[model samples]
Target: MELSLSQCSKLTWTLNVHFIVLDCPGTASEQAGKSESCQGCPNQQLCASGATKAPDPAIAEIGAKLSSVKHKILVLSGKGGVGKSTFSAHLAHALASDNTKEVALLDVDICGPSIPRIMGLEGEQVRHAQKRSKPFYVDDNLAVMSIGFLLSSPDDAVIWRGPKKNGMIKQFLRDVDWGELDYLIMDTPPGTSDEHLSVVQYLSSTHVDGAVIITTPQEVSLQDVRKEIRFCQKVKLPIIGVVENMSGFVCPKCKNTSQIFPPTSGGAEKMCADLGLPLLGRVPLDPRIARSCDEGRSFLCEVPDSPAAKAYQTIVQSIQDYCSNRATEVQRAT
Candidate 1:
């Protein structure tokens, strides 16, 4: 009875829940009763049936509560400085590059958020509009939320205890205006700390789904990544697969490929093989990739023909296949 009721509720407000937003200058804590509905009301965007802009947040609220979104994936890494954020940024850009799907990137990495920089948009923060806080929309197909965008500067270090961090993330999940999303990719901070625990626990409570572990080809990194897999299994979170980053570097001058990270070096793929997980794709080290990041542009979105771009696309396609097969497998299991 409850499930049927929930589905019906989602259908009832499907049209009005999704709205586009741009951030304004203000602190989230200081802003109260502030909105930018005048900019672009969602009711106007949701339909063309002569439906005027909605005056209430109820429609969007219903969409959040009841809508069965296609997927909520976490792009995770076992260790820090592993290009996990880059992987996430590219995955999202690849997914939404077509402008056919409604995609969102949720930066749960409160300590170190790079989504804003990776996506090539800076100086935008989450803003409240139309009686709901809106994710900063970079394009028609993509919306992003991150502490990096909210913080005044990149070097601005946030110092808060565990419970507070958890509460803040929960608030993002609960209050921020995520509507009728085809996918929500959460980029998590490295380490199995309170931040990670909070995220996994919250998703478990909400049935939000699983993650993709990012790792390098080095055995040392793979060792840490293996611990991550064990951690996921402990928490009952599903492992989508493993993404091998910095597999090899190709020289642009001579078109020569170099084995910067040894093949079977870290045994990441072997670990996946032993554990029965998919090998999503391998990414190479590209100087232009780092340059693009330094320039604050998404490598894939800005330069689609770049090696980084193609690598990300392959990973995106692999994920698409995984989801398709997983869905079918689920149906059969049931």
Candidate 2:
């Protein structure tokens, strides 16, 4: 909850049962008794009632560091094994393909950092800086950062609690040397939990471009994807669009497409219409796409003419258009 305070005074708030006192810009005595400074404060009741507290201090640093980037897009899936990470890797590669633009792919899935292996940077290590850490360079236009890089071995497991995971996420946002970039595509773990809340809170100051949700054509996946959509709505994050992956299977030799996971009653297109969201595109499943991923090669780059690759390009174009339109609106508002 947000309350606009018109006056400056000492405010006492509790966080996790611990009391924290903050000195506002006005008189100190206003916190105790009625004063001129507290007359028009919108948050007077909140402060007096001690209902809410200030956000974490690291948020400011996160915002400051992320301000250099033009856009931040989160790639998330409600259910696991939905090809979310693969989509993020391809999206980043496609965006960075333009030599004029810079892009950073941040793998925020602490427990499962698949981006490094998917992007073909498995054994890379993170370089340290005085105040931040350097991202591993993929090329002149592309860079990547992930906890997988910090591990001594690929088989090492990340055993952490909610607070520990949150702290690491804060560190990633506040201390990463992203430099100036056109986009930062974050691949989040499946589900809305501590990591998602932490990332959203840290980036509150930065205007996050939006989120791209991924789902398959099955009802089971769509059910979870529905919850993911509601999570975005509850958090007020704009849904740029949705992509239906593995919607169908394409034959390599026959050049024919078949619905492997055909919708029983409805699919992404119908669901999007019901939710008032745009169905970005449908990506048919192809064996070459999986083969490319396993080989740590971008299917989009390796087989640009494939049906799945073409679908990805179409979705990327839609996202670019959305961002361009949002930028124009911001310029007009300013």
Candidate 3:
């Protein structure tokens, strides 16, 4: 059943599977004109104020939608606290900064949905549509959605079990109103948990294109990255390579670089070489980045001159280069 809304006011409708978001003023006219019921829309009744809530999104239906989307990439790591979410947010932000492409950041880390906060969007939720949950825009080129948006407060915990976590992820892939996107960056939670497995399961079936594994230069984190790579191998999910984060720390006083974590077993370069995947790039432990994120700001604009921002730009550019070169290699082999 659909909710019959009388204007976009305080008229409450029981929560349904989906809500008629298109019932709003101008959008309603456009959608109604395209629907099968358009021919019989009498007296302009549909747009004349009395509108109803749309049905909830079918579970599989939403997943199918995501599967069809082009350039869906899952960002994963073997462990937590390696700034995976920050990398996801910045990467999406970098892509969105370009006027040519569309970008979306899906915070699959439901427990600590940091993308909303990292991208300078905190305490933001879906302004419209009470029934069907959807994503909201961070800006023109970039749009973001996270469970954090739905929570009553930022401190709230999801507290879901396996089945529930799995369902929530499936819904995230399916139901969040992600429009046409050029790149969809999925930030999975740390480690191989139910939630992480769910993201992989969803994307692999929904035609997930590839994955980017994030890790720090420390041996502790790199060990897990290798395992994560192996897991992808078992699942047949394409690996795009690894990113070394918090690779080093930069000084503000004398500008000296210091090691934060123990060097990886094979070092960053050798580890990638051994794994036979490219070492995407290494990010220094820059305080500006953490400060910016904590303050709910995008350092892309503010810290372009900082080490972290430059590294981010390099990472995105390198991804483009790697993709282009790989395309060339494929064409040559063909």
The most accurate candidate by TM-score is 2
Q: Tell me, by lDDT, which candidate is best.
A: 2
The runs of at least 3 residues in candidate 1 whose Cα sits more than 4 Å from the true structure, single-residue gaps closed, are 1-66, 127-132, 263-266, 329-334
The per-residue C-alpha lDDT of model 1 at residue 160 equals 78
lDDT of 1 by residue, 301-325 (tens): 5678877678788888878777767
Error of 2 at 258 (Å): 3.3
Model 3 CA deviation exceeding 4 Å by range: 1-63, 127-132, 322-334
The better-scoring model by lDDT among 2 and 3 is 2
Among all windows of 10 consecutive residues in model 1, the one with the lowest summed lDDT is 24-33
lDDT of 1: 0.72
lDDT score of model 3?
0.73
lDDT of candidate 2 vs native?
A: 0.83
Worst 10 residues of 3 by lDDT: 14-23
What's the true lDDT of residue 181 in model 2? 88
Tens-place lDDT digits, model 2, residues 205-300 = 899999999999889889999998988987799999999999888676797878888876488898899999999999888888788877778999
Return whichever of 2 and 3 wins on TM-score. 2
